[model samples]
Target: MPTYRTTAVDAVHNDEELRLNLDLLEGRRERAAIREAKAKLQMTKYYNARVRGVTFSPGDFVYRSNDASHDVAGGKLGPKWEGPYEVTEALGDGAYRLRSMDGTILPRT
Candidate 1:
């Protein structure tokens, strides 16, 4: 695959521009390094800025991410915030098994 270069993510502010200019001549290996750095910078930006939701632990109640909203109780029956799904297993990094509000064991939605 071709390398992905990111100007925005790898920016050196105007003051640092002169100092960073030499990295341009750093060749393919260093170019690759800068590419990786730019990717990591983008990932870090996403984690630091774009990610806004709060994290909950084992017993905490978290809303399920699915869009089929319905209300199951209070005599209302449409798609409601499915959980307060008790976080069960931490599958890999972002995936988890959630206990449905109705006590059904469903894959993390």
Candidate 2:
């Protein structure tokens, strides 16, 4: 039996009616839970799809993307990528802690 009742009439109903009402509430709750689970699963799938598959390992070389403001010096001809920076640490997911080729750790952007 459910601890909560859906209607005031349920309080005055016979045992059978009360049981049926409780069952209905339980079924509704079960369905709601299932719907929530499915929505979460769909969102997870979408997020995982959008996440990059690339992973960086410590000691790997990579390029930093150029900042837009700095591009004025080279104008449209400026190189879009800077550095063959060395990866100092793998920060998980697609993030990395990077160092210059000279061994200087770059500040976080």
- For candidate 1, write residues 1-109 as lDDT tens digits: 5456544445547547756666655676787999999999999998998767655566656677435443354344455455567776666566666776777777422
Candidate 2 per-residue lDDT, tens place, 66-100, comes to 88225336768878888889998887877889998
Off by over 4 Å in 1: 1-54, 68-81
Candidate 1 least-lDDT 10 residues: 68-77
Stretches of candidate 2 exceeding 4 Å from the true structure: 1-52, 68-72
Which residue pairs overlap in candidate 1's backbone?
69-79, 69-80, 70-78, 70-79, 70-80, 71-78
* Location of the lowest summed lDDT over 10 successive residues in candidate 2: 1-10
Q: After superposition, how far is residue 90 of candidate 1 from its true place, in Å?
A: 1.7
lDDT of each: 0.64, 0.81
Which candidate has the top score in TM-score?
A: 2
Q: Compute the lDDT of residue 58 as modeled in candidate 1.
A: 66
TM-score of each: 0.38, 0.48
